[model samples]
Target: MALSPQDLHRIAQSRGWRDGRVEVFDTASGKVTVKGLRATRHAARYHLLNGVARLLGLPFLQAAPMPGGRQAQQTEVARLRALHGVGARVPEVLHVDEDHFVMRWLGQDHLGDVIQSHHPQAAALWREAGDALVRLHAAGQYLSQGFARNMIVDGAPAAPAWPG
Candidate 1:
């Protein structure tokens, strides 16, 4: 089910990205996450660092925004849609507005959590996650931030759809 902005605000936690807000809300259907980029002082720091890097002929900080002012929400949606169309297990996008977007929450657990569990199912989970990554890459989907925590594991035999 698609979540409204009001629903997202209701379940918002105090914690979120340094330059944005991320809230996970639970509903009768499942969890949904609302991610939005917020104006923050951190942007200045990033820009400064990027400028210094350019002057020094060094690589820009990974945390710095991409060149040409890429819009995070739109980029993410495009990537998700591409991945999904190629049969990559990925969360279905419910809504989008400028800097904000909502997507179905895969689950509480991610590959990071499962790998640390040491449970018997950990191996299977890892295999599934790996397979999903392979599929995504094979489809030419290159995730700039490829972290295990970004891949969700819902304890189902099949891999849970991924959430960014």
Candidate 2:
């Protein structure tokens, strides 16, 4: 079933999710993370950054604003599919709507967290992450957010794997 905004709100509330752009809830199949996209939600911030970059004559620093609702959602879905197709460890998209999409929950820990906590497998994890990125780039796919915080650590010390 296509989930509307109201339905998402209800599900989030029922599951005691805090108010945020992303919510994670469990279903019979598995846990999924649903993200609501608002094209204009961060317009002011993007505009401000763009203005600053333009004033500094740094066109390359200009940030692209989110596209319209449907387009943004579509782009996200397409990117996820593309990345997955390239054998990149990314969330598997399960459902979508004009304003929201749901993906399988990879894990709870971020790569940054694991590295900061000095996990025993940190070095191996880093190596695996680097390998994954090389593979992704070799496939001509790139991640807009390649920061450690944006990378999720699926399995760590016990069963180290590439960050998703």
Candidate 3:
């Protein structure tokens, strides 16, 4: 099933956020940050969401800390680091909290906003992003939240391959 906008909204609000807000932050040291308070209900929803994510064989709540609270977040990071062994690419998990995670943010503008222009660089990036998805699926995994923002576009597209 597709992620409901309502699900997004509830999770968003549980973090005390609203539309168009900078729930994300950039510290002076070039580190990126996001802040939210942990909500039990929100965490429950994440648990359900995680079930779907695992079925896809992709990381879920990689950003969410476990129940031991702050300590658990550290464990989550250690667990995700192992994904490179299986060929997964995610931003560096910087710091974790009961409610939020900081990562090495490779920033970008909204793809829709930028897509209107036929920039050669952007087109190449899109194709590469698609290929990344294809690679993940070939590993018997997929992103439960299959949206453009979740993807990180590297320099160029990898060669095409048959989709699973």
Full-model lDDT for every candidate: 0.66, 0.74, 0.51
lDDT of 2 by residue, 1-164 (tens): 34456555555454332247788876655677888765545578888999999999998999866765677778789999889877788998877755677888898888887887778777787787888888888889988778788889885643345343
| Candidate achieving the largest TM-score | 2
Tens-digit per-residue lDDT, 59-99, candidate 1: 64435464322265667788887777777778888776655
Pairs of colliding residues, candidate 2: none
In order, how many clashes per candidate? Answer: 0, 0, 0
**TM-score of predicted structure 2:** 0.74
Give the range where candidate 3 is weakest over 10 consecutive residues by summed lDDT. Answer: 155-164
Is 1 or 2 the stronger prediction by lDDT? 2
Ranking according to TM-score, highest score first: 2, 1, 3
lDDT of 1 at 139: 68
Using alpha carbons, what is the TM-score of model 3?
0.47
Candidate 2 positional error at 4, Å:
15
